[model samples]
Target: MSSSAFKSSERKLEAQVKLNDYFQEFHEKFVETKQAFQVFKTKSFFYPDPDFIRTFTKSIKQIESEVKEMGGSLSRLIGNQLGTHTQKTVLNSMEDVKPESHVLHTVSDELTSEHADVLVKGTETESITPPVSEAGNDDEVLGSALVQEGNVKVVDVKKKLSSSEKKRGRKKFLGDNAVIPKRPRRSLMDEYVTAQNKMKSISEEPSTKEQEAEYEVQTIMDFKKSQGQYFYKVSWRGYSVEDNSWEPSSNLTGCEDLLLEFYKSRLKQQERTKTDDLNYQVMPHDANHQHILHKALFSHINNPTQKDYENSITLLASPKPPVLKSQKEIAELADKALSQKKKDRFYSVAKTLVENMIMKELTGKREKQLAELRTWERNMNSICSDPAKLAVENFVDLELPPMDFVYINECIAGEGVTIPSDPVVGCECTDCFTDHKSCCPNQMNSWFAYNKLGRLKVSLGTPIYECNKRCKCGPSCLNRVVQKGRNVGLSIFRTTNGRGWGVKAMENIKKDSLVTEYVGEIITSEEAERRGKIYDAQGCTYLFDLDYDKGDQNLYTIDAAKCGNVSHFINHSCDPNLLVFNVWVDCLDPDLPRLALFAAHDIKKGEELTFDYNSGLNSKQMAGRLPAQLTEQKEEGCFTPEKRKESRSELILKTPKGNRGLQYVLNVSIFHNVYQ
Candidate 1:
C-alpha cells in the first residue's frame, strides 16, 4: 500500500485491461473469419452451379478484403499496446505486459479451422461437375447419385426406365399395355457378368468362324462402297475373362478379297450397261442407209455443189452462208505445205484455190469472182509472210542477218551434211550448185579435220556437201565454213515421218540460253478481232491477244491462240523437267519490254526441252475439261489424216502414254551450238 506497491498495482491493472482488449479484438476477427468460411462452404458443392461462380468469386474477394482490414487493425492494436507498455516501463521500472494465452489459443484454433474450410471448399468447387442445368435438375441428381454408387449398368436401360416412368400414369393405351419385358434392374457388376456370359456364348458358337468370315466380307464390301467416300469403322477387342480387358481381333486378311469382290461386281455392272448400250445403239447398216438417203435428199434441197441453190437458201433464211472448207482441213493443208519440198507449191496453190472456191461457192458471186480470187491469193501470200517479215524488221539493225540467207544442214551418216529438202533449192532463190571442196572447202576441211581447238562460225548461207574422199589438209588444219547470215525466228527440229522429234537433240544450243524470239504483231484485242477475220476466212492459223493483267501492270499478258503450236507438241507428265516463267529482257526499261526465252527448268545435255504452257495460264474451265485417261473408254472411228496426226502428237506429248488434248514440242535451241 506504499508508493512503489501502489505503482505496481496500477501497472498490473493497466496490463490486464490491455490483455482483455486484445483478446476481444482477436475474438471478433476469428468470428468474422469463421462466418466467411462457412458461407464459402455452403456455396461450394460437389457439382457447383455455374450461376454460383460469380457469387463464389465475390465471396472470396470479400474474405480477402476483410482479412486485409483485420490484419491492419490487429497490427495497429498491437503497436498501440506495445507503445503503452513501453511508456509505462519508461515511467516506472516494470516488465512489459503479454496478451492473454487463452485468447491467443482460441484465435489460432478458429483461424486454423477457417483456413481448412477454405481449402476444402476450393477443392470441392474445382472437381468435375455436371452442366449448369443438369446440376440443378432432380433427375440428374438422382442419376448422378446412382452412377456414383457404381450400380447403373447400361445407358440404354437407364433411358428406357426413365422414359417408362415418365409415361406410366399418363397412358392407358394398348401399345403401352403390350408389355415390353421389364429390364431386370441389376447392379453394374451383375450386368457386366451377364454381358461377359453372352460374349462367351457368341465366341463359343459353332458357326463363329463362318460368322466372322461373313462379317469381314460384309465390312470389306461396305469399305469398297466407301472407297472415295469418308467413313469410319468400329473394331472390337476380344474379352479377357481374367483381366476384363478387350483385345483387338487379329490377322484381318479378308479385306482385300472383299475389295476385289466389290470391284468385280462394279466391273460386271459396267459391262452389263455397256452391252445394253451397244444393243440399243443404231446399227452400222441402218445408220449408213438412213444417213446416205438423208444426205442425198438434203443435198438436193441445199445443193452445196450449186452456188445458186446455196445462195437462194441463205437469202431465204437470211442466215450466214456455210463455209465450203473446214478450218481443220485448211490447217492440215498448211501444215502439209510447210512440211513438203516440191509439193509445197502444190499445197499453197491448192489452199488458195480452195479458199477462193469456198468464197465463190458460199457467196454465189459469178462475176469478178476470178479477180477477187487473184486478190485473195496475193493477200494470203502476204499474210503468210508476215511472221518472216516481222522477224526481219525487228532484227534489221540488230547486228543480225536476214533469215533467207541462213542455210541449215543436218549431220547425218557420220559428219557429212544432209541438206533440207524443203525450200527446194530452185523454188525460192536461184539454185547454186557447189561441190564439197569448192563451194564450202572450209566446211569440208572442218568435217575432214574434225579439230577440237578454237571456235567455228557457221555463217547463214554456207552450202553443205558430202565428200567421199578425205581432205588433202591434215587434221590440224581447222577450216570451217562461216555461213553468211543469222537464222532468225523460231525453228523446230523434227525427224522425218517420226511421231515426234527423235532421240538426238538439235546441235549448237546450250541449256539456260536464249532460244529464239517470238515475232508477231502486238495487236490489241480489237485489232486481233479485226485481223482474225482474214485468218478465219483463209483458215490460216491465228492467235487471240488475251489480257492476262486486267489492267494490273504487275501481271503478264499472253497471246492465246485457238490453233496449236510447236510448244503444244510437248506432252504433260505428272513429273516434269521444264517449267515456264515469263521473262522481261530489259527489266530497267519499260519501253523495251521484249520477251526472251530461258530454260524453264534445268535440263541435262540430251533431255528434251519442254514446258507446261498451261501452267499459270490455264483457266478453271480448261483444267476441268482435260480428259481423264483412266476413265475414258476407247472406241474405233474414222478420222482425217489431220486428226490422226494431232492424236499422235498429243499421245507423244502427254505423260504415261495416253491421249491428251494439248501438245508441246521440245525447243530445238536447247541443243543448238549458238545457245551453248
Candidate 2:
C-alpha cells in the first residue's frame, strides 16, 4: 500500500477514537446528572407532615416518570452511536474508507441543537460549507475522497457542522441581504458538558443531608399520630438560620433514650414535691373510753334516793255506818291510823308502814334492782354499738378485747358495809379451801363485802364462792320441794390465798368482757368545774381540797371510793392490753349514766387485767402521774418497771371534798399473789 494512503487511514482511526471518548464522557456525565436529580427529588418528597409528604411524593413521582422516558430515548441514541463505531472498525481494513455524509448529518443533528444561543458570533462558518463530491461517477471514488483528509477528527465535529448549516440555511431561505443579529458567544460543549460534570459531582457526594431531612420529615409526620399534636418544632444537629451557627437541633423524636431520660427526671421532681407536701400536717387522738366511765360514775352519784321523799295519806269523814263486824273493825283501825294531826299523823303512819312493809317491799325492790343491774351490765359489756337496720345512719363499731380477762360475780348483801356472814355451808380445815379464801375466811364470806357503795371491789386472786342457803319449810319451800328444787347460789367470790376473799366469776372470762355496770351522775368537764366553784363559793367543806386549773378549769368528780365496784380493779398500763370505752348508757334515759372498759389488745387467761391510763390523756399529764414506787434508781430514770407495775396497785377512790378532790392510792395489790 502507498504511504500516503496508510497515513490517511491512521488519521481516520485516531479521529474516530477521539469522537468515541467524547461521547462516552458525555454519556457518563448525563447519567451522573440524572442520578443527582433523582436524589434531590427523593429528599424533597420526605416532608414532616402527612399531608405535605403526600404532596411532595406525588410531585417527585411525576418528575421521575418523565426522567425515565427521557432516559429511554438517550439510551437508544447511545446504542446507535456504538453500532456506527463498531461498523467502521471492522470494515476499514478491507475497503477504501468513506465518510457517509447522510449518517454524519443525522449524528450531528442529534448531538447539537439548532438554537442560536450556544454559538459564537462572527466565527467562520466553515462547518456549513458544502460536502466535497467525487469527480467520477464511481462509488469507490466518492467513498475514498470523503475518507481522504480525516478532517472529522474535531471533537463533536458533526454537532458543530449541523449547527452552522442550520444557521446558514435559515439566512439563505430568507433571501434578504440584511445581516442576522450577532448570536451569543459560548463554548460549543459548555452547557451540556458542564451540566454533566456538575451532576457527576453531586451523585458522587454522599446524600447525608437528604437522608437526615427525610428522617426528620418522617418523625414530624409520625409525631401527630403518636403524640397527637399540631405544629411540633423539631430540633437536631444542624446549622441554625437564626443564630447563623451550627448546633444540635433542639427537637429530637426518633431517639427513645433521650425521651425516657427526660420523662424519668420529670417524674422524680413530682415525687419530691409530693413528699414535701405531706410533711406539714398534724396527728390525731382517741378518747372514747374515759368519757363513758366518767358518765356511769357521775350518774350513780347524782340520782335521787327513795328515802328523800315522803309517803302518807288521810281520809274524809263519811255519814253511813259499817254493816259487818269485820268491816266495823277495819273502819275503826283506819280511823285510828288517820286520827293524828295532818303532818304529824302522816309522818307517824308512813314510818310505821315503811317498817311493816320491809319484807314484801324488799323482795320486789331486790328484783327491780337486779333487773336494772343486769341491763347496766349488758351495756357495760358491749365494746361497740349495735348495727342499725337503716342504711342512712353511721355507727362507730367498738373493737372488743379478746376473750379471757373479763368476769362477772353476783353480789351478796352485807351489814353496814361489813363483809357478810358465810352463806355457803360445808366447811373443814383451811387446807381444803387453800387459795379459796371465800370458803375459809368467815369475815370475807359474802359477795356484799366486794361492793363499796354501788361499785364492786376487785383484787387479784380473789376467791369465787358458791352460796348454800337452805329454804325454810314454808309454802315456797314446799312448792320448790315438790318440784325437786335445790337450795344453792350460783354466785362466786374472789379469794386472796386462803386468807382474804372477794367476789369472783366462776367461768373463764374474756378481755374487755362486761363485768358489771354502776350508775352515777354524768356531768361535763365545764359543768363539774362550775359546780366545784359554786361549792367553794358556798363555803362547802368538801370543795376545799379540790384541785382546779385556772387555764382550762375543767375537772372530773367521782363518788368512786364510796361506790367502788369490781370495775375499780382495772389498772392502767403504758402498754395496755385493755381499752376503756365510753357509751351514752341510755341516750333515751340520760339520767342513768355509765361507763365501760374494753380490752384493746389480746388478754391471756389469768393475766392481771390492765389498760392504758393515759391513752387519751394529754402528754403533759402522763409524766409523774403514775403511782409512787420503791425503786433504787428513782432519781435518774423517768420510769422503772417496778414503779410502773406499782401504779396498777393504786385504786381510784372518792372523798367528801366534792367528787373532784378524790385521789388514787396504792392500797390494793395486783401482782401480790404472783410474787408470793
Candidate 3:
C-alpha cells in the first residue's frame, strides 16, 4: 500500500478501537445509574427524607450529563474515520439523545461480528451493498464500514427493531447480548490505550469541595502594584508553590499583620539601599584616608582628656614658630580634631547596632512562640472528632506557655478520688426515652435529661441521667447527650481585656445545647484546699467543687490547673452564658457527678464562654441576675439549697489577677429532657 493509503487505514483501525472503548464505558455507566435509582427507591420505601430525595435528583441529572458526554465522544471518534456526510449524520442523531436510548442500543443491534471485522480491516471492493432489514421502516443509526478500494464508499447502517425486540430497565439491549456476536479481542496496545483514556476521563471529572472551603494563606510570596492597586501572591498553606495565587489586598481582609510585615520589610529595604548609596558616595578612595581616620578615632575614643588636647594644641603652633615641633606631633593634633568632630556620630551608630540586636531577639522569641502554639493547635484537634476546629491565637505579649499543663479529654482521678468506670445497673429498654420508668433516667427518679434535638430541658442544678454502656439503646438514642462530647466549635484565644486565655464559640449555639464536659483532675476536698492555697498565692486557681447538696461539705473537687481539657481555660463571669449541671452516665455517685456545661441562653459566634466561679449555682444573687428563662423553666424549678457552700475557685488561664477576673463564654448547651 502507498504511504498515504496505509496511514488512512491505520487511522481507521485506531478509531474503531476507541469506539469499542466508548461502548464499554457507556454500558458500565448505565449499570451504575440503574443501581443508584434502585437504591433510591429502597431508601424511600424504608426511610424517606427531603435531603435524600434532593440528593437522588442531583445524581440523576449528573448521570444524564455524563451519558451525553459519552455520546459526544463516540460521535467524534466515528466522525474521524468516516467521510464528512456520514459523520454529520451520526453526530446530529446522538447529540440530543442519551447513550442508552440511541447510541449503544442502536449500535449493538446493527453492528454484527462480521461487520465489525470489516470496519477494522479494509475491503477490496469499490461499492458495498447495505444489509437489508426485516422491517422496511428501520432507521439509519451510523455510517456503514468503510470499503477501501481505490476510491472509498460509505454505506448507511440501520437498526431494525420491532416492538417485541425492545427491552426496559437493566434488561435493555447493551449491544453485548447473546444474540449479537462479540468482536475479536482487542490487541494489548489498543487495550492499554483504552484504559489510559478511561483514567484521563475520570481524572478530568469535577470534585466536590466538601473537605475544605477556603485555602489557608501560608504567607505572602510576592507583592505588586498595578493601576494604583496592590496584589499579593499567596502561598496557600499545605499546598505546593504551583498552587499559589495572586489575590488583591481587599481579598486578604484579616491578614493585616502579614501585610504590615511585608510593607515594613519593603520600607527597611529602601532605607538600607539609601544608606548604602550614601556611604558609597561619601567614602574616600585615597589609600591613606581610611587609615588616618581610623587611627584618629581609635586614639580619641580611648582618651580625650584636657591634658591631651592642650598638648596637641601646643604641637600645632604657628607656621614659622612651631618649626621646632616634629611633623608627627602636627599630624596627631589633626587626627584628634577630626575624631572629636565625629564623636556624636560614633555614639549614634553604636546605639543603632544595639537596638537592632534587641529587635532581632524579640522577633526570634515571637516566631518561637508562634511555632509552639501552632503545634499545640495541631495536637489538640488531632484527638477531637468534632468538625469545628480549635485554634490558638495570641497577639498579646511574649507570655510563656502554661507550664506542666497537659490536654486531657476525660477527667482523671486524683488522690482520694475514684471514678466509677463500669455501671452496676442500666436500663434494658429498647428505646430509653420511649419507656421512661424502665429506663436509666428512672433509676434516678428523673426523666431523660435531654430532648430529641439533644438540648437540655431540666433547670439549673438538676442532675442529668444519660444512657450508659449497659443500655440497649443505640448511639443515636435521645437520652445520650453529655456522653457525645462537644458538638459546637470553640477556640482558645487570649483576650485583649487582660483576660489571659479564654474559650469562645466559633459557631452559633442554641440555648441548652451541650457545649463541653468540664474535664480535669478529680480530687478530694482536702487536696483541693491544699492546692487552692498554692493557687491563691499564685493568683490563679482551677478548683471546682462538686457541692450539689446544700448544707454539706463537698466530697470531690475538680482541679483543672495542670491536667485539663479546653474547659481548663474557661474563665468566670457574673452573668455567664454557660451553666454547669451535674451529669451521670456510668458513674452514679451523686458526690462525684460529671460537670457538664450547657449554654444558659442563645449565643452568637465569637462570644466568650464563662461561668460563675465565686458563687454557687443555687445562689439567689446569681439567680436574680440570670436571664428569666434560665431561672424559670416549666419542667422543674432551679434548685435552691437551704445554705450554700463557699464558692470554690474556678479554672482560669494563667493571666494577671485583674485580667483573670474578666469573664467570657462558649456557645454550647445540652438538652435536659428526652422525648416522651
Specify the highest-TM-score model's number. 3
Best by lDDT: 3
lDDT of each: 0.30, 0.31, 0.56
Q: In model 2, which regions exceed 4 Å deviation?
A: 1-50, 58-74, 81-201, 208-676
Model 3, position 101: C-alpha lDDT score: 19
Model 2, TM vs. native: 0.18
Instruction: List RMSD in Å for every model shown.
Output: 32.6, 36.0, 34.1
* Residue-level lDDT tens digits of model 3 in 1-676: 3558645654554456556655554544443444455556556543445455557657655654564455445545543434366444543454332232123334443444333333222112111223223112223232443323323456545455654454332235433442222331222221233333443443343322222245677786566666765567898878988999887654664465555455445333433453322332111122223343334333333434454433333222212222332446434443343332233453344333333333343556656877888888888789765545677876555555575788888888997777987988888888765566688877766656666677776655456788889888888888888887888889888775778899999899998888888888988878877888888899888877776642136577778888888888888887778877778898888777788888888989999998777544344433543353333343333221111221333311111111222222212231122101
Residue lDDT tens for model 2, 11-60: 66445434534543443343333345445545644343434444654664
Sorted by TM-score (best first), the order is: 3, 2, 1
Off by over 4 Å in 3: 1-361, 384-388, 617-676
Indicate the TM-score of model 3. Answer: 0.41
TM-score against native, each model: 0.17, 0.18, 0.41
Q: Lowest summed lDDT over 10 consecutive residues: which window, candidate 2? A: 388-397
